[model samples]
Target: MGVVKDWRDKELSISEVIRKYPHISPFVIIKTDVQRRGVNYTEKALAKVDPDIHQVEYRGMFREKGDATPVSLILRDGTSILTAFSVEEGKREPILVDVIDDRIVLVDQGEILEEVEYWEKPDYYDKFTSSGKPMWQIAAARPQRIDINPNQYCQFWETPGHGCKYCSIAATYNSSKENKPKILNVDDIAETVEEALKEPGRYESIFLTGGSILNGKELLDEEVDLYIEILKRIGKNFGGKRFPSQLIGTAFNEEQLRRIYDTTGLTSYTADIEVLDKDLFEWVCPGKSARIGYDEWKRRLYKAVEIFGVGNVTTGLVVGVEMATPKGFQSEDESLEKCLAEAEELAKHGVSTVGCVWNVAPGSVFFNQMSPSLEYYIRFADGLDQIRRKYNLNVDMDNYRRCGNHPDTDLSRI
Candidate 1:
C-alpha cells in the first residue's frame, strides 16, 4: 500500500501519478497499482488462457484456490505483474484484465492502460515427477525462474499473536479442500527441476522459499538443512560449484548460513525482513520478532552479506505495510520516510533491499485496510532505486530478468 494523496481519502489516479513522475516507467506504475488494487478478468480476457499454452493454474499463496485465470500478467516489456484474485472479500476496486482489439490489456474504466499477455507455461508444467506427483506442484515456474516451496505450512501460525499480520499462508493452507503435502518430497523436487531445465532459455534462476521452520536444532536449522538437501540434488544438473540460485528462508545465524553456502551450489541468499522499521516489524511480524528480534535480524542479514558477498545477499520488504492501522504509521509521508531511511542503512552495509507492493490479502489482518496512494508508491520506488545508486549496490539477483515482483527492481531494467 503506497501513494501520496493530493487530498484526504483521495489519491491521484494512476495516470495522474504517472504524469507527476515522468521519470518512472508507466508499466511499473500500472503494475504497482494493479498489485495494490487487484485485477478482475473479463470473460474475453479469461478466454485467452489456454491450459496447454499459457500458464494458468497456480499454487496460490493468498486465499484463492488456484485454477485457470492466467496466473498473473506480463507487460510487453517483459515486466511480470504477480497479482492474484482473492476469494474472501477485501476493499478496493480492482482494474480489469480485458481484451481490446483482440489483444490482452489492462483496462481501467473503459480506457486501456497497457497491453499485456499471460505467462507462458513451461514445458514441464504438464509433466509428472518420478514419484507420480505433478511437476507443476513440485516446482512452480515464474517467467524467468523456477520456485520450489519445500514447506507448505508455517510453524508461526501455531501460536496466536505470533503470525505475520499481512500473511495469508496459514489461512490459505487451512481453508483449502484439497489434500496436499505439508513438506514436499526431495525426490519430487529434484525430478521436477531436472525436467524443467530441459526447457531451453526458459529459466534464469532457481528460487526456494517456504514458511519459517522455527523448530530446528537451533532456531531455523531445519529450514536451512531442507534447502541444502534440495539444492545439492538440484546442483547435480550443473557442473559449477556455484549455481544461479537463491533461498529466501528464515534468518539463519552464521553457523546455519555457512552450512547452506558451503554445502550447496546456491549463489545468492535472501531472508526477508518484511517490514523496514523495528517497531513496525514487531507489530506486523510478531513471529519473526519472537524468533529473531529486529536488531538480530538485521545483524543476520549483515552476516549473510559476509557469506554470500555483495550483490548476492539481499533482503525483501513488504512495501507500504508500515501503514497498517492501530499500530502502523498514520501518514504515507512518515511511512516512506521511515522505510527508505532503514533501507539506506542496510545498503550502506552492502545489503540491497527489494520491495514488493503490499496489497490487503483476503485472510490477512489488514483485509479491510486501504493501501497508500499511487503517488506514494511511485515516489517510494524511485527512492529505493536512488538509494541503491547512492550505495553502489546492485540488485542483480532480484532484477527484472530474475524476479520481477518488485516494481522497484523492474526500474533497474531502465
Candidate 2:
C-alpha cells in the first residue's frame, strides 16, 4: 500500500480500504473510520432518537454532559462505533448521521455509507440504588458488557505536564457538573451490578477501567486495593470464586497482581501501554514513563501473564499516536514495523495486544494533531490480529461481545 502525502488530500475512501483488505470485515473498517472522525447527528437523525428506548445520556468518565444525543451507533452485525460530539475549538468536523429513505444512515462526503441503529438503553439504566443515586451513573453499559469506572479522576494530571498527550480525562472531569459522584460507593457499584445481571442474556462480561492512581504504599497499590474492594463486592453476586470480569488498571508488580487474582472473581487483566515505541511511550505518556519506565511496564505485563495465565492477559495500544508529529515516527511504515515488533515480543510472553483507534480528543495535548489515515488503522488492526493468531492467542475478554472498542479484538469473533 502506498502512503499518501497529505492525509486530508488522500482520496482513498472506506470502500477502497474494505476492497484492499478483503478479509477484514467492512463493518470493522467503518467502525474504525467513524471512531477516527467522530459523528454528529442531523436534525432528522436526532428526531429519530427516543430517549426512552435508545441510550442518550453520557454515562462514562470521558464525557461530562448527560445530553439526550444518541450515545453511539451499532452496525447490522453487532459491531459498535463509539463516538462523542463535543463542540470545542479546533475539533474536526464530525461525519453526518442523517435519515435516508426513512432509515438512519451514515453520510460521509455526501455518500450514504451504511445503515445504523442507536444503542438500546439497558434495563437498569433507569433504576436508582437505595442511596437514591441513579444506577446508570455508577455503571455504563455496552451491548454485551457492563462498564464501571470506580475512580473517576487520574492523578497523573496533578503533575504539571505528566498526563498522556492523547488523553482528555482531566478536562472532561473538570468541565461538567453532573450529579454523579467522584468516587463511586462500593455498595452502589455492587448493587448496580446485581441489578444489571438480572436482565438475562443481556450482559456477557463486566469491565472495569479508569484513570491512573499513582499514590500507594508501593506504586499503584492504592489502585490495586480499590479494584480488589470493588471486585470482592461484585463477587457476592456470583456463586463461584471467579466470574467473567476484566480489569484494565495500572501496571502493578507481582504482589499487587496476586492480591487481585487471588482474592476476587476477576478473570482477565489488561494494562494499556498506549504507544508501543519506547521513546514515544515516554513522550506520549510522561507520567507512566517517569513512574514506570517503558521496559518495566512490559515486565509488569509479562508478570501479569504468569498470574492471569495466557490468553487472559493483554495490553492495549492507542493505534495511531505513534505517528503524531515532532516526536512520533515520520513514516507510517516505520511506525507499524516498530509497533508490531514490540507487540510480537509481548505476544511471545503470553500478552496479547489490542488496538483502539486514537481519537485526537479536544482538551488533550494532541488535540490539534492528526491521527493516521484510515488505511493505516486497517493495516494496524490486521497486523495485530494476525500476531495473535500466529501465537494462538484468544481475546475473548475484550472481543466484540465483551468490549467492542478494539477493532483487532473484533476480528477474533470470526
Candidate 3:
C-alpha cells in the first residue's frame, strides 16, 4: 500500500515544508532541486519532442537531445530547469517529464509539479553562415541571452589527472566532435550575433566562456587577446558603446584584466573558482593550483572589483564538489560550514559567489561519486543567498535574466 500523509505532515508537500521560508520563491526551490536531481523523460514525454520545432542539441558540450527527450523544460513562472546529462547512481529517482493533456509537466511519484514549454528554436539556428558552419554552433541563443563558447576543450585536461574532477569538458568535447584545432571565427561570431539580435528584444545579454587556456607569452595572454578581439567585434554590433555582456573566463592578473576592460565593451566579468577551500581546490583543480595557486586566484578576482566595480564583477563556484570522496569533507554540515565560510570571505572582498549544483557526469573522472543531499543543497543555496544580501552585491551578469545556471543568483530576484 502507498503511504498517505495528513495536512499536518510538513514533509508531505514541498509547499508545506517551504512555507516557513516564505522569502525563498517556490520557483527557485523547485529549480534548485530539479538541477540537483536532474530529470528523466517518459516514452510518452519523448514522443512529444519535435526537433524541427523544439530547441535541442545542434552544437552542445554534452548529451545530444533525442526526439523522446524532454528537450529541457521551463517552470510556470518562466524559470529554466535543466536536466543534468551527468547524474549519480544513489541519488533520488529523477522526476519524469511527461506530456499530459497536450502540455509538458513534471511528474514525480504520480504528482504533477508544474507545466512547462520547450525553448523556442532561434531563427538563426537553421541559417548557415558564409563559411557554412551552423549558426547554432557559432552561437547558442537562450530566451534572453546569447552564449559564445569560442573554445571547447581546456588544455589543462590534456595533462594527466589534472582536469577538474566534476568537469567532463574533454570527454564531452571528444564525443560531440564540437572541438576543432582552430579558434572560432570572430567574423562568424559577430555575424551570428547580428542575426540573433534581429529577433526583436529576444536577448538582453551576451555571454562568453570556454575551457582554460594556459598558453601565452605570459600565462593566458593569448586567451585574453582572443576575447578582446572577439569582444571588440561584438561591440561593433552595439555601435562601439558598452553593451550588456559577461565573460566567464580564466582568472587573469590585473594587467590582463585591465587590457580586457580597456579594449572591449564587456560590462561584467567572472572567473569560476570551482571550489571554495584552498586544500580541496589544490586536489580537485590541480591544474589551476599548479599554475596560479588558489590564493592568487582569489586575489585576481578581488582585483577585478576595483576595475569593473562592485556588482559588476563576481566569481562562480561549483557547489557540492568539495564533497568528492578521498579528499572531500566528511559530513554535509562540515562541508556547508566550510563552503559558506569561503564564500563569505569572497563577499568581503566585494566579490559575489554564484553556485551551480554539481551534476556528476558519466565521462568525468568523478563519475561514481554522489552529490550532496537535497536538504543540504537547499540550506547551502539559502546560505549563499544570505551572504550576497549581507554584502549588498548584485549579479546582473549571471542573474536570472542573463544566465539561468546558478541557483544562488536566482534567489536574488526576491
Pairs of colliding residues, candidate 1: 1-372, 2-372, 3-372, 3-373, 3-376, 4-376
**Comparing 2 and 3 on lDDT, the stronger one:** 2
Model 1 CA lDDT for position 1? 41
> Global lDDT of each model?
0.84, 0.87, 0.80
User: Candidate 1 lDDT, tens digit per residue, 1-414?
Assistant: 442333335778888888888899999999998888788888787777777887776444542323467777889888888875433333556788898899988988689999998888899988987778989888888878899999999999998988898888988799877788889999999899999999889899999999988887788778888888899999999964788888898889999999888989999999899899999889999999987999999999999999999888889988878887888888888888888999999999889888888877878877667667788888888988999888888787788877878988888766
Off by over 4 Å in 1: 1-9, 58-67, 85-88
Better of 1 and 3 by TM-score: 1
Structure candidate 3, residue pairs in collision = 46-68
User: CA shift at 330, candidate 1, in angstroms?
Assistant: 1.5
Q: Candidate 2 — which residues are off by over 4 angstroms?
A: 1-8, 58-67, 85-92
RMSD of each: 3.2, 3.5, 4.2
Of candidate 2, the 10-residue stretch with the lowest lDDT total is 84-93
Candidate 1 contains a number of clashing pairs equal to 6
Total residue pair clashes for candidate 2: 0
Per-residue lDDT of 146 in model 2: 95
lDDT minimum window of 10 residues, candidate 3: 1-10
Off by over 4 Å in 3: 1-22, 58-71, 84-90, 177-182
| lDDT tens digits by residue: candidate 2, 360-389 | 777889887877888999889999999999
